[model samples]
Target: MIEDRPYTGLFVLDAGQGVAGPCCGMLLAATGAEVVKLEPPEGDWSRGLSVRKGPESVLHAAWNRGKQGLVLDLKDPAGRAAAQALAARADVLIESFRPGVAARLGLGPEDTGPDAICLSISGFGQTGPYAERPCTDAVAQAFGGLAALNQGADGIPHKTGPFVTDVMTGFAAFAAVQTALAARAQDRAAGRPPRRRVLDLSLLAGTAMLLASQIGEAALLGHSPGVPNVPAGCYQGSDGLWLMVTLVRDPDFVTLCRVLGLPPLAEDARFANFAARSTHAAELVPMVRDAFAGQPRDHWIAALQAARMMTTPVNSPVDWLADPHVVAVGAAPASVQGALGAVPFPAVPGQPQPRGAAPLLGEHTAEILSRLAPVPG
Candidate 1:
């Protein structure tokens, strides 16, 4: 068993709700932090998502595992007091409430112990016109300029189905927390205050940062170019499955031509080089697509591999779970359970599995609160 616990002995207060903040907490707990997920008396809203087995939803269970569950309604004075007490004792506190809500509730960074790392996560960040707006994953995608990039040309902007921006924000928060921890440590060694070591992060910023390359390309080129060259997208194989083939260089085009049995294209002057092939892509791509229609997906995949060209069947999520490669990789969950379950929880490269079951709503509140008795100074 690979036991990964770099953040061992670290206590984390997860006061955020929904995907991004909760995901941040999950990543932290997975890295060996003792995370306490503070939710409302009812439950975290994510518990209402995906397929549910009893009180637990797969989405909620998956992210909340390896953490103690505590319920506190910040709207209630007593609840707010409990939250403050927890924050005072925590090594880190994570909150995703709207801009000023945390401060109003008396659980904001300024309210926490000077050394506690308070990470505030939001859709647009802690300031700006959109900061206070109610934001979702799709909203962030559109606001961050990423939704406009789902495709090119046809004059339609589409939002990605996955909560890509949300997940990205979570990852950004994870990295920020680690960095903050390191910074605070260094500052303390230098006899500086730890409170000066961190700042909040936003989903919009994280998503936009991911577009650095694309934004640069758009600026330099001045026109949207879908994919370079031709036959570089999804196509239907004879077996009726979609396959993607990318031809980055001239030799790749030559190999693709040979595998598709369009040997003429390999020598054709109109398709001689990348620029020529791209210019005549409309003519060559359709012909190549037609050729691929003559062979099953496996036949083309094998032939393309044999020819040393790039080709792969585009798989749906279910298909991916059943894929031989995916199964061999331990990518999919062995089985979804409330806790780490019997399966090895999938982790980021080099990170070990953090183990714990998703607690029932407020399941640990009494125990957590009971254990919070004043420490002898």
Candidate 2:
């Protein structure tokens, strides 16, 4: 077990139930914060959404590691009061309910103690025109223009395979909280009262900001370039193995050609420059594909790397688990017994692997409440 540090004793009030808010709380907890996951009496909606064996659902494990759990019926007056009381002493409050939900429940930032940082994560921002409406990760992705840029075959826009919006919003919320903490520390050092702040993080806004490069291209030019515009795409080798290549500059293009045993494509009149290569991508891509198809994936990967070209093998999860680099880096640690029996989990970066399991529902309710109650004089 790793020794705990002083002053990192942050309390996280996770009023949010889904991936976005819980993910933010999890990151804080992993880094040695005292995170208290506040769940409703009926538990989070995510707990029963899909394939769940028990409290050990994949989603739950992925989002609630290293955190304590507490269940309170926020709809009840006593429950709401208890949550508000906890928030009054917390360093950070993360809520992902629709706009105005926390305020209605009497848990808004204004009701919290001085110097508290409130992070509000939502589909839209707290003050947007559509803030009152409910939305999901897919909805936010579509609304954020990312769907348009992620179009698949037949020109039909598609949602990303994973919950991209939720994940991005979680990362944004964590960043906002850290910034607020830094500001508060500065204030304390200056002999001033700690400054309280509210972060209004929206899934749509976070995802849009992430697409800044694509958006900028579209704003300056008539359209964003297509995926196969340059020597950057997956190619099938002759052995039926696939290799991913990314050539960004003239040197990269030359290196790609050298690796493929072809004359420098960058020196050719028809494919000499970015513009020319883009125009001739249809011809160039197939040539590269056919050349790569003549060799095994490992051979081409080595050849390309030797030429200083960027390349990677497209691998599935099984391949990733057995990869040499993954083993060398010790990404996956040995199975450990928690509330749920022995389970394999990834190790924390720069930290020893946590041996504790996720908390059962309300596992720390009695202990936490005892600490929160005032002592009689």
Candidate 3:
């Protein structure tokens, strides 16, 4: 556990469902904020997503760790009143509703008082043609140009297997919240009243941020760069394990050729330099591929390292979990929740590992709501 708990006294109202907003709230919880996850009567939709055990599902565990739960049906007047009361006292409020849904429920930033920081996460953004349209990670990837840039060996653009865009949006939202918190703190120190801060983040915006360089290249260069490096891709060995190889300079290509026992190809005019190799890639790459096919991945890995070339085995999730370096660094730490058992999650690079399991539906409702009750005369 990290000893630095900066947000120890801060209260965060997390009225977000699914992944993006929950992820930011989870980070706040890890940093010692008192986060209350506001779910509907059926609980957060993520609780029913995949592999549910009791009140928690894999999605909930992955994104809602370390937060308390409050079940509130926004459509119900009483429930909406309870949420509004909580938001009024909150230091930060996070929601993932479509454009005007939060305002309709009276939980929008304008309703959360003047000093509260509000973060709204959505598919496109708050004011856009698609603001009201629903979207998911897959939709964001396809619509935000990520799929277009992630071309596969088969020449088909494929959305990543994981929910990368949603996670990216979460990270972006977290950063924005931190910035707002810092600014608010500065205002307090300077003896000035802080105004309300509203942050709008979207999956499409996050995807665009992730592909910033690619977007710049497309617009500035007016065409794709097409394969930045020749022969620097995945190659399958005889053992059927794929290894990724990369060459940064002309000498690295020489080293790769030497490692593959194709020293003559390094001197051959047709494949001598980066330009030549790129031009003749259709011919030269096959020769390198055939050479890699002659040996197991382990053999090529050894030879490539011995020659001081950049290379690594293409790792699956299982392989990553068992990787020696990952183990040494404690990259993925397991959090044990009763009944749910131990769940391994990647540790945030500079942040503390989350301390608790996701809360059960409305787990802290009674205790939390009682605090919001009016004082007796």
Candidate 4:
């Protein structure tokens, strides 16, 4: 078993309620940080997301594990004071409000400890002209050119289902926080005062960076490869299930044809090279799809594996839960106890156990406030 390293008791002040900021806090907490999630008296907006038992919703539980919860009305003077007190002692502060909101609350980087690292995640950025505009993940993706790459053959753009911008921003914020922490540690070792830093992490910027390939194509070739590169999509298997294939090399294309029992495709001029394969993808994909459709998913999967061609069936939640490899790697556990009953939550990667369910709202409020109270003289 891999030994788990406990977080060295770094404090995190999570003032943001939604996916972006909370996800950052959650990652920190997973590494053993003491994350204090401050929500309004009514609770974080996500807490009321579903009719789950108590104040914990499915979304809230998934994003807020390993963190303590506190309720404070930021609009109230007392609430603001409590928040500032927490911020002063915190090592990291993550907020995802519109630009200027944290500053107005007096909880911005300048208002916190000099050593504190502040991560301000927003739709645009702090200094951008559109910083104050309210935006969602889809809007950010569109603004960042991700939606442009998602256009279909019809040339109409479509939104990706998941909130990619928010998720990517969360990951970026976590990285920035870790970098700040490392820098602060170095400063302390050198006997210099730890410098406070404010990271302006924009969802739009994060999404744009994630589209490096698309951006590079436009810059170098003067045109964007609108959809996924050819030979990198779902293909039909003989047994009616879909198998996704990604052939990055001409050799892999050869192996792909061999796996399908077609040797002539590799010799054909149109499908000979990667560039040619891409140009003739319309012709090649139908052939490959039709060949795959001739066999069952398992037979093709085995054949692809035998040829060392990258492949997998289109996996659903059910497929993942029942997969032998997933079970062997402990990706999905047997069951999880929730307020409703025992439900299955996927296992943690490289860990023996899945994380516990999120704590009840304000479950530790009394104990935490008591610890913070001044000692009697």
State the weakest 10-residue window (summed lDDT) of model 2. Answer: 348-357
> TM-score for each prediction?
0.90, 0.89, 0.95, 0.89
How much is 235 displaced in model 4, in angstroms?
A: 1.6
lDDT of 3 by residue, 97-140 (tens): 99889988978987886878999999989997889989999999
Clashing pairs in 4: 237-292, 238-292, 238-293, 238-294, 238-295, 239-295, 239-296
> Which residue pairs in candidate 2 collide?
237-293, 238-293
Question: lDDT: which candidate is best?
Answer: 3
lDDT scores of the candidates, listed in order: 0.80, 0.78, 0.89, 0.77
Best by TM-score: 3
Candidate 2 has a TM-score of: 0.89
lDDT digits (tens) for residues 225-328 of candidate 2: 55534868888877788878887776777777877888756578888866778888878878887888888898999988887788899987678788999889
Candidate 3 C-alpha RMSD relative to the actual structure: 1.7
Candidate 3 backbone collisions, by pair: none
Lowest summed-lDDT stretch of 10 residues in model 4? Answer: 347-356
lDDT agreement of model 1 with the native: 0.80
Cα error, candidate 2, residue 41 (Å): 2.5
lDDT per residue (tens digit) for residues 1-377 in model 1: 57667898999999888878888888889888999999988888889988777788777876677889898888889888888888887888898889989889876887777788888988888888888888888887887668777754476888887778877888888888889888878878999755733468888887888787777778788964444667677778888988888878878888887777788888999988887877787787789889888978888888878877777889877787788987887776554465434433355556565466777889898899888767779
Off by over 4 Å in 1: 152-156, 267-281, 333-336, 339-345, 373-377
